[model samples]
Target: MQLLILMVVLLALTTFGFRLGRGRAIAASGNNPRLLHSLPRYHGYYVALWSGLPALFLIAAWLMLEPSLLHSAVMSALPADLQGLSEERLALVYNEVRNVARYGHVPSTDAVGQAAAGYIGVRDTVFLSVAALALALAVAGLAFARKRIEVELRARNRVESVVKVFLVLASLAAIFTTIGIVLSLLFESLRFFQAVSIFEFLFGTQWSPQMAIRSDQVGSSGAFGAIPLFTGTLLISGIAMLVAVPLGLLSAIYMSEYAAPKFRSVVKPLLEILAGIPTVVYGFFAALTVAPFFREIGASMGLSVASESALAAGMVMGIMIIPFVSSLSDDVITAVPNSLREGSYGLGATKSETIKQVVLPAALPGIVGGVLLAVSRAIGETMIVVMAAGLAANLTANPLEAVTTVTTQIVTLLVGDQEFDSPKTLAAFALGLVLFTVTLALNVVALSIVNKYREKYD
Candidate 1:
């Protein structure tokens, strides 16, 4: 709340700085705007940028350091014995102090009360000091910028340079974050591979991660084969593609080629509305509605059907992915040049023939790209598979049987209170690495195909 109040105060001050700068520029120009190099608004923006940027940078740095500095100060003041607590115990103590400081709750004991009181005092003092310093810096910046607002001043160029630097920093931050995550996963997966062989993890038919909680507890017979996991993922994704590709393509064709403008506008949004529905809701519908429907149909035909089957999950997943294929395909198909169709018509080709020879071919790359995207979505899906397909890593190709995919297994292995040093937890990282690699490969292949066909179209 204090931070919010400080931000609001700084915002008002920045607005005042903008008005001050604009008024100064106008006064310096003797009310002749042409005398100024840049527009009056640019001078105002220059002051606003200068006034806000440095103060925002200071506040950001203060917020980052304030917690750790306060934590250390509070801990140093603790009793010698209390200060000797383990790192985990110290963390708990810090949480208590923070909770008390934020909520002003009465501590259960005198010791805790003293710590919380100390934390509150230090936090309030720091907040006020930092807030004062930030405002003073902003005011100084405002004055400097206002004084520089002259006929030859290039305020807009300076502002743009600052913006470009910020954008580059933001991009670098995102890239470094991704690199950090991938490196962490790679390192953990290497640890897992030390316990279990890469060959076993990749080609083994069984995946029993729970059987080994400790390094010494692992048995040679403990199934770590990831064949079933890979197979299950492929089966479900293949089934999803079977359902999605045809239906989505047909819908796209009808919407783009056959439907009138009014009908297309109304129905397109309605179809795409399915994409907006949450995956959890789809999971619930699949488990309660789709699974039972499939079982009943199988029973009537004297066939055995698992209560939780991949077929239900894949079908539901396909339905979820339909919009991706339909929407992108529609856009690409609509983008097919009218001259191609006209030439086909001039060559005595029928409407369907022109569509088949010219339109579909022209849009084929985009259609393939969209289907590849849908395939990725189907492969990464967790909730629908978890709810509709059981967690059994059965190595059968039968969609009627219960099976689990790599993503579901990753979730299962990482869910409970397991030690990170154990093979079971490490297996999650291994599975994640494989999933990442496979997704990367798929993206490469998709991009390659898209590029190849794009050249022809271009």
Candidate 2:
């Protein structure tokens, strides 16, 4: 509530700054546009940025740093015994203090309650002081900016420089975030590897993570083999790609080449609606409808099938991803220059022959890129597989049997309050790392294909 109030006040001040600065610029320029260095609106934006940006930035910084600083201070002021406690115990103690402060209820410990009260007092004091300082700075910035708005002042350049810096920071944020995720995955995976051999994890076929609770437990050998998982993921994802590629590409080709504009507009959105449906809904459909249907058909054919089979999951997942392939391929195929089609017609070639020989070849790179993206989506899928394909890591290529995926296993291992030190929990991280590596490798291959084919056209 307090933060929201601060934001509202700052926004009002910024608006006031815009009006006052524009008025100041007009008064200085004698209400003549040609006399000013930059437009009056730019000067207004300049003052608004001055009035709001510094205070906004400072308030954000203070909010992020306040909890840690106050927690440290509260800890320091505790009794000798509490101060001497281990870090973990001290953390628990601080949590109790926070609870007391928030609820204003007596804690089990009186000392902790007093400290919590003190924390509340100090926090409120600091918050009020900072809000006051922010308002003061905003006022000062507005006054300075309004005074600086002259016929000679370059407000446009100053505002654009700030905009340029903001854009650069936004780009750097994405790059740095990618770096951070890779580093975290790598470190946790290294920890898991320290406990379990990477060679065993990659090659061994058995997949039990809970059989070995303790290293010294009798007849309890822990198995962390990931080959079964790899095969299962590949099998299901390959099935999905097989279903998606031909259907999606053909739909794209037909829509782009044969359909009229009005018909295309109506049908395209209805087709893309599949992409908006939640994966959990797809999972429900697979589990309740598709799985049983497949089982009955297989039973009639004298073939036994599990209630939850990879075929059902992979088929539903393929249907879900078809929009991805179709939409991108449609755009790419439509982007092919009309001159090529015109020349093909000039050569007395049929539309089907031209599409098959020239158009598809021209759009192959983009189509491949879309297909690769759909393949990644299929591999990363979890809910549909979990509901339609049971969590049995059977090392087989058959799509009609129950098989689990790396994503499903990762969710299963890390769902509860399991300790991170256990191999079961750590296994999730290792799986994530491998998944990341594989996805990165796939992206590299896709980029290479795109670049290779792109150069031919250029």
Candidate 3:
């Protein structure tokens, strides 16, 4: 409520300052407006920016730094008995303190709460001091600018420069965040590589990650071979592509070319409904419905099939991805120039011939892009594989038996209790880095192909 009041006051002051600044400019230039430089609105905007930006920036900076500083102070104030606690234990204590301070309810009677109140007092004092300073700076800036708001001042140009810098800073922040994430992943993957050879991890068969928990333990061999996981991911993705590409492309073609307006209005939305279905629901369908059906069919054919086979999960994933491929391809195909289709028809080509030879070729790049996106989706899928595909990593070409994927293993390896430093848990980060790289490469290639085709048409 206090924050809201402060914001409202700031907005009112800025708006009033803007109007006042513009009025003063107009007055100085006399009733003859032709004598004024720039426009009245620009002057108003300049005053408004001056009234709000500096104070807002200070508030934002204070908010970001306050929690960390407060938490550190609280940790330092902990009693000597709590000093020997592990980092995780200390974190738990801090969390309890925060809950008590925020809601006046402690989850436990820990000593952390006492220390937290002290920290909270300090935080409150610091925040009040910062807010006062910000208010004073804003007042000083407004007063100084108002006094300097002569007809000759270049306020418009100055304000425009400030706005441009603000926008550039916002863009740079996003780019820096992405760079930070990629660098963190790279460093962790490098650490995993130090523990396991890249050649073995990439190409070796067998993927039992269970290893000795302690150096003194005997009979421990940690196999880091990821071929099985890769194979399973490929099998699932291939199956999804097989199902998604044909169905999605055909649907896209019909919608874009042949379907009547009424039919499209109904069917397009119906297809989109598939995309909205939660993957967890798809997981259950793969487990309870698809898996059982595959098992029954295999039994009738006298072929061995695991109850939780890759085929069932892959098929469901295919079904899930159909809408993604179809929606994107449909838009791309529809966007192809009508002139090309007309030329094909003028050349005595039939509808199917024109579609197959002319329109499809023109839209092939986008179709490839959509298919690549679907493939990436399949590779990263977790719930369906976790529920329907077995946990045992089987490095084989046959999709009928049980298999596991990179995503599935990552979930299994990190679920429940975990030690971040252990190889078993750290392997997840390595797998994630590999997955990220693979998907990124696929997107780049797909986009490049799309751009090349677009250039030819353009």
For each candidate, what is the lDDT? Answer: 0.88, 0.88, 0.85
Candidate 1, residue 250: lDDT = 96
Comparing 1 with 2 on lDDT, the higher-scoring candidate is 2
What's the lDDT for candidate 2? Answer: 0.88
Clashing pairs in 2: none
Per-residue lDDT of candidate 2, residues 1-458 (tens digit): 88899999999999999999888888899989689999998899999999999898889989999999898889888999899999999998999999889887678787898899889988899899999999998998998898888988999999999999999999999999999999988888898899899999999898888756577864266789999999889988888888888889889998999999999999999999999999999999999999999999999999988888888888898999999899989988998889899999999999999999989989989789878878877888888887777788898888888988899899999887888877778899999998988887777777787677667666
lDDT of 3 by residue, 1-458 (tens): 55676678777878887897788778777855566666776777777777788888888888899888888888888888886799899888888888788778854766766876886698778877876877776676677667777677777788789989989999999999989989988887888888888898889788988897676644166888999999999998888888888999999999999999999999999999999999999999999999899899999999888888888988999999999899989988988999999999999999999999999988988888888877888888888888888898898878789999999999988899887776777888889899999988887887787677678767
How close to the true structure is residue 280 of candidate 1, measured as C-alpha lDDT? 94
TM for candidate 2 is 0.93
Which of the two candidates, 2 or 3, achieves a greater TM-score against the reference?
2
Kindly report which residue pairs in candidate 3 clash with one another: none
Question: After best superposition, candidate 3 residue 156: deviation in angstroms?
Answer: 5.5
lDDT of 1 by residue, 1-458 (tens): 88998899889989998999888888888999889888888889899998998999999999899989899879987777778899999888878877887898767667778888898889889989999999999999999998888877887787778889999999999999989989999999999999899999998877877664566764433668899999999998898889888999999999998999999999999999989999999999989999999999999999899989889888899898889889989988988889999999999999889889989988888788778878888888888887777888899999999989999998888886888887878998999999888887777777787777668766
